[model samples]
Target chain A: MSDFLFKRMTLIGIGLLGSSIALAARQKGLVEHIAIHTRSQATLARAEELSLGDSYHKDVADSVKDADLVIVCTPVGACEAVAKAIAPYLAEGAIVTDVGSVKASIIRQMQPYLPKTVHFIPGHPIAGTEQSGPDSGFAELFINRWCILTPPEGTDAAAVDKLAQFWTVLGSNVETMDANHHDHVLAITSHLPHLIAYNIVGTASDLEMVTNSEVIKYSAGGFRDSTRLAASDPTMWRDVFLHNKEATLEMLGRFTEDLTALQRAIRWGDGDTLYELFSRTRSIRRSIIDAGQEVDASDFGRHIVEGGETRAEQLKSDDHKDTGS
Target chain B: MSDFLFKRMTLIGIGLLGSSIALAARQKGLVEHIAIHTRSQATLARAEELSLGDSYHKDVADSVKDADLVIVCTPVGACEAVAKAIAPYLAEGAIVTDVGSVKASIIRQMQPYLPKTVHFIPGHPIAGTEQSGPDSGFAELFINRWCILTPPEGTDAAAVDKLAQFWTVLGSNVETMDANHHDHVLAITSHLPHLIAYNIVGTASDLEMVTNSEVIKYSAGGFRDSTRLAASDPTMWRDVFLHNKEATLEMLGRFTEDLTALQRAIRWGDGDTLYELFSRTRSIRRSIIDAGQEVDASDFGRHIVEGGETRAEQLKSDDHKDTGS
Candidate 1:
């Protein structure tokens, strides 16, 4: 009897998520063979260099041929085209899934094109760093992180469990929810936060009174935290906002309303109101830390890295990484 | 002949910044004696227990008597009262400074009460974590950080240089700028970011469609980053918004305007606009990292800590910290 979850597993894109899944699946020995595919030859070559899969395919259909599992790891906007291209080649009883931030739209875009013979489970591993591309992948990226699966209603239960088991082996805590509800939950938790980070960084850059240098110099005060999220992959975030329009806008509306009220309190010098809101928001951070969703260290443990090395030493190390003229 | 910068140094509040200053100054051997005071006897006792200072005083006036350096580390809202209490006792030629977030307001609040015999330099060290209080301070807190000193015009340049040297010895890069200009810079860099963070956390917690538990569970997606800033001291942040009202409101208006445009882009599915804004903001983070204002690691290096231990192991360690029933 085979111990592997599947005899063949194919990845349809080779970016941060795709490469990470490849590394993680192999590290856990979850699949017997892994096939990687991407339209960009540069990425495909890089994945091959990284040895992220057992085989690399430039053609999307060839990548999934006879594969028992196919995971599409493209930007949400490209999911429909990928679904169409790989739909015909997927083996019978194959579990097809895509890792997209917006699940409802992913279902809307990919579900119709997928064959009825295969199980379609839309999943989002709520795990990533600001860095992108093949080199950014690491097997430990999913450890202790949440991977949400939004399998469509009436989907095969056994197939859903199989996919969940795969994510579980990769060290993720799996949860299943209605696709629309997942969209709403993620809108407030993920999309709105990224939108706000990008918007603030733009505002700080464009300010006439405060030069960008000054902003950068003093960013440790608070602004640097926003920059981490703002530095995420532009194409991916753009696709997320476009695909998750309704929930994103709804959450953004609420955020703006709350901000307006806070603005009024600041302008009117309502110290009590400001104090109340600021005080209440603090507990949520404690709750997150308690829930093990956040690092318990202050400033996300940046100080540990910083305190380990002096500024001059850090600069010298960074200079070594820079290209010499 | 002594190597110490000052024969006596006094801190008027024993909070995060105050305690950090005590630790850093002592660590650098810049002060021969450190005197600490706070209105709260509990905090003063706590500081004494921590041995953060050479002497502890219950009376603010007594703390500054014979002190050549007095730094009022109280909230900006309490600066006027602290200045009034300590002015009569501050030694002649003593350089009085503050670590308030709002420079102009600190000047307005404390300058009038200070005697001309002493130099009043309003300073803000642009570094902190979300945690506050006496226990939340470290000697390395000011290392590689920028400390802005806003000394009023015609004040003795010698005294300004002396204070600047003091901060530099404590591992800070000190910059002298006009008080109002410092306020404007910090309004954009620090105050507005905190406001937005506090606002977003508030919005997330109040969502009717999304449970707070769900928000906490999946916060690793992006929302968790904002929580760090929102977790900062409520009393300190309240005073910052109240004291830095004009510049903060101006920056808040700009931020809101920019965010509104981004909101419109999302609503209209303007992918190009979103992509452009997202792509451009990434460079700011890179600049900050280059400037040594932020950690260069991805996700602020949270992964390093997480990858060091499995979730179950981390939970076990955390349980050890909890009080046993």
Candidate 2:
């Protein structure tokens, strides 16, 4: 949102992704007018008091009446309902998009509800954190990350390009792919890793030997990394699995097979095989760092807490003492 | 090592852990003289060049003569060989110990070679990075980590107490457990994590659908964390598995079963199960942060590149283009 990409931009969720889009839009002057909407009145009030938008509404239909652009930023499960709620009031020729993680499901759910006049493009900014809520976002969240657009077979090329430009303004590198490929890629890169983190942390925490204090004290770098992934918003992740079930199951199958091979290697005392696998994996990390997608410092995770610290200030605002920041 | 814990110390193999022990011992003035010996003459020369020890020797027996404390820091496979190399020359009142990860294996391998007159204790300072060789050693590596000591039933209490004090001085909290239990806990806590990391990275790297570059570019926090664990030293980890085979196999069993359960949850769209697992894991991370082992922040894995930036200066040395920073 480096300039006025849209005169009136409407964010139809006002959660972490939506609030972040609003923040980045305002900071970069991408939009002249911002309309924030959420189903909860308390959340809408919280967003308003925090100056998240120039206009606020509890109903999606009320908020997107004349919006030049409407960005859906709710959980995938809620996207279809919100789309249905807002479609009747959507301005003709309005560009509609979302920031959901799973493209296929969100598109499958929301596209049918929107008017054919509105460009219903599905895009996912490959960026986020474990923390959620309106206050837990920043303008730089999408910086240097990928914003992938998974448009259906008959998507309007002009509309998709316009949406891509919008993400580009937010400092994201854009890529175009079919919804299925996008889902498959994300399953391996994002969803599976998250499941592993959540699974291992759950397992370790439940262990009698590695109690809360012991695991906490002994976590070191590797375990700490897993915790961050594991700490992600539970509701968001649950919806992701529910919506993107097929791709996730496929990725899980592959992961289980790989893990089983490794278990056998260890059981059989295959030292050379273990060494080779361990060595190869190290190279992938180096490649990631070289590709500029990752950092080599220990404090990448610390930035989340720092961002959250800034967000905790929202607690001081009377409007959001209980609702949100 | 504070206030001269020993007059002379002997290290049988000067690899990462051995060299780290030397550095930590010297940094705290734990020993007046450090006698370094390794089977590899080149390693001994490198240690001398780094000034890691007061004296360096190719022969383990020649190095340990008259030393008050003898520490074998070779791979577990080399323990018996190194013990026999230094056995005939060990002083009657000298203390002999090792920093091997597996206590039972090391005890079985080395105890027979040493004289009963000397106090023999088996210890593993639960520390280290993926890097290896003498140059990778640092004084702070053991700080805030656990050092599990598995002394035998009839081991001298005074000797064990003194070694515990030594580890405490090195900034490691001393935790004594039976050899079997220590191996089991570590198997679950460290070994299994590393194995999983290696396997996942290997799987991703080998994927036909995903290019390595794509995986590298979109890695995010989850993948980077796994890579860090995967990047751990191959030889050392190989030795650990070979030595601690049974415990590792047992832990692997639990992990595999748990992972299969998670896979099923994801496949069936079991939101409640996924949420519970994700929620429980989240708390473990928070606890880890409370324990000062992790930074409770977003994208903790993103720091890897920032580390590389500082390493950019170090990388100046990589091309043999040392500009002498």
Candidate 3:
């Protein structure tokens, strides 16, 4: 392994984010020793079985002792408890960070318990999947994805730089913003999309006229796409909505207003209005593709005819027909 | 290539659906001669250039003359106009169908114009990508997908069987339902989803506080999934909403009510409600996968690591880390 930047790295929740960090850190040789801790004995045992860290600790304080970097990887609802549990044993000069989706609330809940000696840098890696648990993690989860660090003002610049370096080493493109701003941005970008997905999927499933079986059978027509986000961890999302309440509500309000107008347009037979809104959204997807944030895979890249061929070749042979009457 | 099902098959619009039908029909040797017609001479020339049909006709009537099977593959808004144009020329005892998402409205628009000798079955294939136009058509577009045919109450059973068989040959699993039921089913499964996608994408783009560039750059955090549907053809989607107004509005009403409750849950910090709703939606996604409607591809199956590897292998290596704190 390459020379380590830190003598020890402690992860204070060996779940998806924690285990992923451990695996990523170990893969990159960023830390000499990795300590993993979770509240549950079964999960600690599971982490141990997976070899997610050098040491598996049942006690939260024990996990943070002597670590140069300690990352709290938990749902936002649990951040305060984790902060209080680990405060006394944390090493001086250690950088404290988190992988929670909400930032301002995490900062609010955590800052009180964390000692002044440690540098508290709140972070959120814009990466994950619907699957969960220690076994779900892989070293390459964060590769090329953005890991946003939302460090409070007056936090040591050196500590922030070190944390950025750590994420860069783990293959993330890092960006920093204020914790409140991060919460607002994520409310629109991540939280709202997830809520809408869950809402629509739930609506479809609960319909009395449309059988749940039929909804599933014919989901290839648009509904299935929303289900991916809906399939995400419920607890994590629940915690997200609870902690980021104001911002999430603000974005949700805006979304509902827009949706209502759209509903009206459809109701009134306003095809022009509908067409304009639909046309405008296409450019955003294009921008995402151009910015390297998304792959230009049509139908979630599910190919009908499998062959040893490039997408270009496949598109050439399987040309699309949009031009019409 | 193989024994033909019909001597001539006329496609009344050479767009995405129409051209795909042409390509698939040609590939399966379902028809000996494919006559494609569009009002736009430019589109007709382009269709000719793509060789999407045996003959490209500017006159709609010329395309349907002597054709045993005629398919109207155009936007729903154009159904009445196309029906009127092709009614006089449709061969006696010919089976005619249209692939439009909203079947009830299309039936109302076209049925009165269509001659009694021709069987006008309204069909909708639950298959498509966001990409459209003549160049986007593929021979395998409908492979392993559902195609719903909404026949009128007194439609000739023999004619319906022939049309169903034609779709089966195109690699679609066929189902027959009444026009009104089909509209309701599709509004939930297809129309509503597209509207939500478009609305959300538009909301993100219209946000003044969040830069469009930032939204695009960080779209992978669930927003990009919606964008895929949002990027679909505006004209087609507009027609869907306009024609299926009642069903779309009903579904939209249900969706809005659910969303309002969800918004309240988030605002009031009712984590249990949020958790339960989120948890419930996951099973629907699983059902979709189990029922062979969706592939279990995490993150739309976008592979970051370049390789000559199958998605199963990629998923195996990228075993997701969802289970954690």
The candidate maximizing TM-score is 3
Docking class of 3: medium
Order the candidates by TM-score, highest first.
3, 1, 2
Instruction: RMSD for all candidates, in order, please.
Output: 7.9, 10.0, 2.6
Considering the two chains of model 1, state its CAPRI-style docking category. acceptable
DockQ for candidate 2, please give it.
0.27
Question: DockQ numbers for every candidate?
Answer: 0.38, 0.27, 0.62
Per-residue lDDT over A38-138 for candidate 3, one digit per residue giving the tens place of the 0 to 100 score = 88787888899988889988888888999999998877899999999889998999999999999999989999999999999999899887767776666
Query: Which stretches in model 3 have alpha-carbon errors above 4 Å?
Result: A304-325, B304-323
Q: How does chain B of model 2 score on TM-score?
A: 0.89
Evaluate residue B43 in candidate 3 and report its C-alpha lDDT on the 0 to 100 scale: 83
Cα distance off (Å), candidate 1, residue B286: 0.9
**Fnat per candidate:** 0.72, 0.51, 0.77
Q: Per candidate, chain B TM-score? A: 0.94, 0.89, 0.95
Pairs that clash in candidate 1: none
Which regions in candidate 2 have their CA more than 4 angstroms from the true location? A1-3, A40-50, A208-212, A298-325, B301-325
Please identify model 1 stretches exceeding 4 Å from their true place.
A309-325, B309-325
